[model samples]
Target: MPLTAALLVTVPVFLQAPWVRSAPMAAALFTLPLLALALVLERRGQGQWQQLGVLLVGFCGSWLGGCLFWGWFRLHPVMHLPIEAFALPLAVAGLGGRWRLAGAFYLGSLLGTACTDGVMAAAGLMDLWPQVLNAPLSEAPLLLQGAAIQVLHPWPLALVGLTASLLVFVCRRLWTLGGTWRVTAAALGTTLAVDTLFLAAALVAPHLSGLI
Candidate 1:
């Protein structure tokens, strides 16, 4: 269940990422249906459905955050995390309540995001963010590929390895807690997996990398 919850975090990357890019308003509005579904499931009164509902509620927060940021602030690299963290306060408060599942998942995803952005900054790829995004469609892939290649340099590669190791360590520790912590662990682990795959895609096939 925790692993499944973790994988759910990636759904938005495939669906919301491109959708928000093309139709920010529509993407933002889609949050309503997701929230409605969550409410319905929670009200069903079955344990399994109620749990799934809680996970979906967490996913809704992530989905809405992505839409809010990628919709209007894609070009501003600096605003990315701040915007993505729009639900931070709520997520934190949800930690000790019945909504711990939601809190764990959101925080895990956010941690993954923060780590990814930190790596980009440390690896000198931050400057390329706006450049690639604002470039012509034909030109963006090349710019993205160049940025990925930079990751192969000795210093950047070492930093990537170090950051990944730290995240893995955290995930292992979280897994031992055996409850919502498991959910957090799974989400964080899946996030790391997704980031690795996205970087690989950017290097080999930037057009399919989902950034443009």
Candidate 2:
């Protein structure tokens, strides 16, 4: 999710006149929300840090492995799906921490995914399909592939950031306060929401044009 937010925020800066010479630094600074949950919910126990480290490694390793394996097989490489779905299981089994944080992470990842997609749309890189009605924001026709936004799109990318961040906050806050498995279940449910939205959009788009 942080990656999504970072990409959305950074891509537009590069598109503008000055170009973001310090884009990476700006990205790191802007990612405080992602790190904040970990900081505030720090566990205090015997070798807690060690456990956290292990959890991080295992979760990341599992996700990367899954992604690589899927991609190598020409599977439609998934995006936020793997990270959100597996992160909780890995953390629970490996680190044995509170489910609350896992819930937060998943919800945060969902928000992040939306932001990433929004940014990609704003940058003319991809299409959000059904929700996007504007021709400028509409995706490429079905036959096209890659980089749709080089025509100097006039739409501001800031809208993506603003809307995505708001959604993320709402989801994340709900996650922090929700029930144990319920939050996890909610995130999993949202994964369906995203997929359904995509499918509906693709079905409705004009057959001749490519989807962004």
Best by TM-score: 1
TM-score per model over all chains:
0.96, 0.33
| Local accuracy of candidate 2 as per-residue lDDT tens digits, 1-212 | 22222232223223311222224334333334434433443444234453343223322333333333322321222343444344545555532454343433344344444555545555654533322322332443432212222322355335543554565566566556554433433443354345334434444543323222
Candidate 2, superposed: residue stretches over 4 Å from native: 1-47, 50-58, 73-97, 121-124, 127-152, 156-158, 164-212
Q: Estimate the lDDT of model 1.
A: 0.88
lDDT of 1 by residue, 1-212 (tens): 59777679788778778898889999999999989998888778588889888888888888888898889988887888998899999999999898888888889888988998999998889999999888888888889899999999999999999999999999999999898899999989999999898889989999975543
Taking all chains together, the TM-score of candidate 2 against the true structure is: 0.33
Q: How many residue pairs clash in each candidate?
A: 0, 5
Error of 1 at 169 (Å): 1.0
Cα RMSD for candidates in order: 1.2, 13.0
lDDT of each: 0.88, 0.38
Clashing pairs in 1: none
